[model samples]
Target: MTASNPASVVPSIHDRFAVVRERIRSTCVAAGRDLASVILTAVSKTQPDEALEAALATGQRVFGENRVQEAQAHWADRRAAFPDLELRLIGPLQTNKAVEAVQLFDVIETLDREKLAAALAAAMQKTGRRPRILVQVNTGAEPQKAGVLPDDADALIASARDGHGLTVEGLMCIPPADEAPEPHFKLLAEIAARNGLSVLSMGMSGDYEAAISCGATHVRVGSALFGERISPLKPS
Candidate 1:
């Protein structure tokens, strides 16, 4: 664990977690918001089991997985080792995989369209398990992303509620990455408010603090909490 060793890591998992937690706390405090309102979803996409073990040692329970197949790959054999972990699928969900997703994820963060909603409804009915779902909104209007357009935020959630047969728990967004995320975060909060939505799931490793400042209910931290994902190209 010498500093110069190639394998030597900075910010022992405990230290990294403390930093992330403190960041959330200070950000929430400075914004005059309740720190407890900000839930943390450790984005565990492509993370190894040992790293997850380290995270668990620090009491990190909720984790976010980007793909359904990856969840099946990572958690299937090792999840029981950590009794506290709750896995959630936080990426775009395919309707065909709805059944498998329900069995593995405690929450689905990407219920975007009517067909997907209907699929989740049918899957939940057949499986007899309903998961908390957050309507994903493309608040930043980035074309390359997967969320619903900003103008349709409320309508999408309504469709999930009326068409999906599941609880419309909240709103989740991935703001444009290259610029300041605060404005987009604030807009998401406003959208949630306008629709009387209770949960706001915005923020990531870079701008989670900003998101918290603007009333983000959940922050997905990966690199800041865990190390940089082995390869950034993959969803985190």
Candidate 2:
């Protein structure tokens, strides 16, 4: 689906959503996976409130954010009005903001290290809201990335599940941008299988089809839904 102008008046959110849903449907059909099994997490990071409202108008309740503060600012008051909105934190989380993260997000997808895990556990206890976690795996072993190294996934998942009393439901990954992501996606699926994990939050706007074929349960897409982001928010 072609994206409308970001500079000009934006296209209807329902139109964009239809395009994305069609893509997802085609991908699922090609992969021989049930359409009901895959989830489309509209990556709404850096998008304005109007975009969110348009999405809501189209019956899109699930959204992904890259920053806690931005999401909190945007959705704090709106959540009450739209009670079913599901906010998934698809960005790296700072340990210091664990409490705020727990308060703001429904699913925390970037739990990669022990320090963050401990902080989140405490925050969940204080808030009495246990957000489902997906341990991020640095499948490419990129030093600059925010996920745990592939080798360390097992131990961290175990720690988050057993020691920290957190519900570690699955694994997430962002493959190296320049390389083919199929291997990395397959590796994550294998890791999740070994750990008895179900959710695989991999893929983005560019490679979601490949990810679904590799068993990605959730695909985070932005540009395909909202056009190119207006601002390049730094990775949090």
Candidate 3:
């Protein structure tokens, strides 16, 4: 199907989804990894409802969102319709939103600090919902980012696992935008390996193939599937 511009045909969500699936399949084959080992997490943040519907129609059940409120708005009602939907919080999570986040998401992929971990542990206990957790590591150590520094990740992971009784499934990272992503992916993989974490949530639309090769178990893809976001929501 084409958009208003006759000169350019816009691929439907199904087409885009198929293309991405093919890419994942081929990348897995090339990496000598099982196709089922890696998951394609469709990033639905900032997308219109119609786009989300289209992706759901295409059988995409795993989605990643950036904000707790936005995610609640997007999936709260639809949960009844799509009971199997797996929601992941891929952005920085605030301690205050822990209860809401614990109730809504199936996986929390941004556990960075001890305070947040404590909040999540409390939230999980209060809500009686234990979503899987992944520690976000600031591999580049960029000051503006929201992840545990490489030097401190082990401590945080241990605390989350032992102290808080939260499940530290794996690690997640967003490499510095200007730098090559493979190094960051490698570092994340190394950390996961040393920490005995099997799930690596370390890729986006731009570098998922490389992430798979570097042992990513979950890849968060957005623009490449939903088209460029037109109106990004301000960070909450």
- Mind giving the per-residue lDDT tens digits that candidate 3 earns over 33-86? 999999999999987777888889888999999999999999999999998999
Model 2 vs. true fold: TM: 0.93
The most accurate candidate by TM-score is 3
lDDT of 1 at 178: 81
- The lDDT, on a scale of 0 to 1, for candidate 3 is 0.92
RMSD of 2: 3.4
lDDT of 2: 0.90
Ranked candidates, highest lDDT first: 3, 2, 1
Alpha carbon lDDT of residue 79, candidate 1?
A: 71
Reference-based TM-score of each model:
0.90, 0.93, 0.94
Estimate, for each residue in 107-209, the C-alpha lDDT of model 2 and write its tens digit: 9999999999999999999999999999999999998999999888999999999999999999999999999999999999999999999999999999999
Ranking by TM-score: 3, 2, 1
Candidate 3 ranges with C-alpha deviation above 4 Å:
1-11, 232-236
Question: On a 0 to 1 TM-score scale, where does candidate 3 land against the true structure?
Answer: 0.94
Candidate 1: the clashing residue pairs are none
Which candidate number would show the highest lDDT if scored against the true structure?
Answer: 3
Comparing 1 with 3 on TM-score, the higher-scoring candidate is 3
